[model samples]
Target: MTPQWLTSIQTPLASAFYKRCGSKEKAKADERVAVIRDNSQQIVASLRLRRIGGHWLLRALLVDPQRRQQGIALQLLQFVGAQNPEPIWCFPYPHLQSLYHQADYQLVAEAPEPILTAYNVYLNRQPLLLMCCNR
Candidate 1:
């Protein structure tokens, strides 16, 4: 069964979710956040979309540790595609290629600048996959 669709989340809550992922980065003012919340209204998973180089790049996909392996990440990626008409860029880890692939994201040889530069930096340190979902 498909998971419940995401709704726009406020900035503070978005930052909280990122913190839950052990990242110090907070949601930017220009970035839009989408989230899946539990019955108690606590965010279970979320991702940020920022317009970079005239494209929406997906970032900071975080799922509650207790909620992993439930396809929440795939559902969130699908939800982003359904909500946007433009192509969305994502730099998922190599291991998550299948998950992003199932969400309609295809492997891309190159991504836009700045983000690509960032991707290269991360790739230098660890394996990463650059994919984009065209809607």
Candidate 2:
């Protein structure tokens, strides 16, 4: 996909993705990874990135809601995964762990982390689950 530029540049794209995923407030956020636009200068999708263990980590990978399942996310992941030969660990949301597992990431151990208020509210109680993929 082609990279995009924006005039409404706001917060960091990674933060916007997490907040969007966490709060489901996509309309209110403008931060993005790579902004793809057509002619009118609108944000189509984001390829947000973050860091882990002192290494650059991919945090959010989103295809404009209308253009999903077309392998955009997979392409983005492949691009990021190839950035370095070092192992990449994705601490995914519970529902998404299976996707990673399908990508050959084995469940290594359960992560025990402090319960954030938002998740704690949804989980009835918070349980930290962890998984890792070997390079």
Candidate 3:
């Protein structure tokens, strides 16, 4: 039931976890990873909070396929939100708006510089929702 939020996600478990989510990038110093694992040490949920231009970007929120429908993602969201009062930006799918809303995140019309650039790129590819949790 214990989870970890660390600056490095280079561990074998983390690598495999991200791979399962279809993203396999090298861990950067500016990124922090949060992981919650099952009793067997298998990752059940995970997300990364990356500091971009002084803003925290939330991404890669992956919950195990078998573990969906549970509150694992919400739990992780709450954990991160509590860890710091800074605003966290996330670009999730439209369907996930309610999920992020439950974590006290509100829809935002615009984003800051670097993130706005990336957001536009994502918007072009798919329908997404941009939200921010300002604490």
Among these predictions, the greatest TM-score belongs to 3
Any runs in candidate 2 off by more than 4 Å, and if so which? 2-44, 102-104, 110-129
- lDDT assessment of candidate 3: 0.78
**What count of clashes does model 3 give?**
0
RMSD of each: 3.0, 6.4, 2.2
On the 0 to 100 scale, the lDDT of residue 41 in model 2 is 48
- The candidate that wins on lDDT is 3
**TM-scores, in order shown?**
0.82, 0.49, 0.85
Clashes of each: 0, 2, 0
**What lDDT score belongs to each candidate, Candidate 1 first?**
0.77, 0.48, 0.78
Query: Candidate 1: where are CA atoms >4 Å away?
Result: 1-9, 112-115, 124-127
Alpha carbon deviation, residue 101, candidate 2 (Å): 3.8
7: Cα error in model 1, Å: 9.1
Better of 1 and 3 by TM-score: 3
RMSD of 2: 6.4
* Two-way lDDT contest, 1 vs 2, winner: 1
